[model samples]
Target: MPIQQKDPSRASTYSWPGVLAIALGALSLVVTEFLPVGLLPGICRDLGVAEGTAGLAVTATAILGFIAAPVTAIAIGRADRKRVLLGLTALLIISSVLSWKAESFATLLIARVILGIGVGGFWAISITAAAKLVPPEKVHAASSIVFAGISIGSVIAVPAGSYIGAHADWRDGFMGASVLAVVCFALQLVFLPSLKMKHGVNVRDFFGLLKDPKVRAIFLTVIFIVAGQYAGYTFVTPYLEQITHLSTAIVSVLLFAYGVATVVGNFVGGAFAGRNLHNTVVATVWIFVLSLASIAAFATSPMFAGLSLLVWAVSWGMAPVGTQLWLYNATLHAPEAAQAMNTSVFQLSIGLGSLAGGIAVNHAGLHSSMWLGALILALAVMMVYIVGRMNRQPAVAA
Candidate 1:
């Protein structure tokens, strides 16, 4: 069925409720995506698989999510975004239910594969949908609201899932996720307006976006920053356990601190980006470099390690908001396509970071990963600086 367009005049009015619904949807999807991270041990024991084998569940989602983002943008083809979102939420519901009942490793992996599709499509459209829900001037705030869900979900998922798995069954965590998705879907049904696309996006649009040097720079910066972050973060627990000599309990508390810092940074970053996009991006990248260096430098001091971790978390929290806003501003003509590309790069870079960090740890030791990450982010700082210079120049007449 063709998506019917709502009255064009409605576009002028803000839909704060609708934006909130999308935020909830984001929360649901993210929780579902990462729940496995905390429940992996239980899953491995139950399914008679090794830890590395169980880890494939996460790898599957990331790899599929990377593919799904751009493909989803092309596949939707001018469809009503409201329905597309609804369908994706429904997919989440199905995936979560399947996961809740999954008894075999194969069954659980299959469920996660379904989830990857939902994750990709939802993220690809969410920012654009959130932007459209309000007036142009409030786009930054709306995007921030959506990003808040991600930050909160990341904080909530592991601990919550772990708690549930410890107290009950790991599958119960997925059941809770399903319940969340169901609520999100219902809220979206009640709140989301018809969101017809202005034009259908195609593969060519993604390629055309790559031709812009600014866009390429933005993506390169994303890769460097995100991959670097993961490289260090992927092994942070070990570093704390061995080098810092913190107990598991203390490490958990510090991680919670990092989570809280991340949430605060998201809003702070959004507010700053709203005021001045270019400067915000530059400042955040620089802060990211410094924070990573601090963590590595103070590896032997628990107080300093914890402090640097919070700072690092804050800088990372700010990063997505700043880079995303930069991408949106640079690709106003095709924001969705650009966002889809951003999503792909972000997912791929996570895998890259983890792999690189793993290699660095295996060879050079735990501290090496953090230093490598900082070095990678230095490149990102340079890219952001060059991009800032490009933006400052006057446009030549075509």
Candidate 2:
């Protein structure tokens, strides 16, 4: 049986399959991007580098993605998006293959840089592309499906890689990811329809979107939200070990449980955003703040710490979908640019949050990082409310 093609012009009916294909792409990109985190120790040992130095493999990908997201969106101006997406996924395949065979830190870093290009490009386009495939009312739902990939990747793929590295050779993790990337690439090639770039964002236009008060507000909210998240999350394992007094095995299990909780939160957030975008977003930020406060105040007991982390995972997981909905609705005409800027902000927030946590850990204490994160989340909550009220654009859903 042949798959019936729908006219792109009349994309009034939702395309769940197409939305799902994009979601899978999101899954593959995230899994590949973060895969090295789990294997860093093995990489250091195998390549004769210190743990701190092997950490560059992760930094390299983020730095490149921070630069590449908007650049790729602009460079591929008016190109057929399906082809662009396919080409980007092909880069992932190549990068993964190179990663598997990497003989030195330099080789692995090179592969990571290549993977960054794919990550940046795929994320820049995926949100808007998914929106185009679905009905207007279902856009948030579609975006959630796509962002759910991020949660799933964090929860499942990275840990799975860590597990594989623990049991077998670390290099096997890269090979396994490479195989997964190939399958995802094939799916995009088969399912994504021909989509030409509409009003590709250049430097001038990109800045113009920022000039819009609503867009600016949304970006500011993201900085605080994500920075707060990473500030605490980046050092969570250490906090667990030192403060919660959990063994390494217990910490690993707890982290895995957090990941599962995050996926559930992703969909829950999406559904709420679909119903009440502003309220849902505001609520999520407050929950995040409370979760951080819990850790900061009462992580002395393992059970208390574990429960706090579970709340943190689920609350933070809602953020991507909620924020993406705000962006898509606020920047109705320039979805690509909005998403690109969001992706760039996301990368920067990770760096900022991690740096903040590092400073806190060095000067104050591990628990201080959680306090800092709570403060940031409090600010984000304020901003989310202000922005939610200010942006009176007709709601995507009543």
TM-score, each model? 0.82, 0.81
For every model shown, the clashing-pair count is: 0, 0
Show model 2 residue runs off by greater than 4 Å: 1-20, 40-56, 103-106, 130-145, 190-194, 238-243, 271-279, 358-372, 388-398
Candidate 1's residue-wise lDDT over 126-172, tens digit each?
A: 98888888976898899889978888888777556555655777888
Shift in Å, residue 188, candidate 2: 3.2
RMSD of 2: 5.0
Query: Ten consecutive residues with minimal summed lDDT in candidate 1?
Result: 5-14
lDDT of 2 by residue, 220-244 (tens): 8998998898777756655776788
Candidate with best TM-score: 1
| Cα distance off (Å), candidate 2, residue 121 | 0.6
User: Number of clashing pairs, model 2?
Assistant: 0
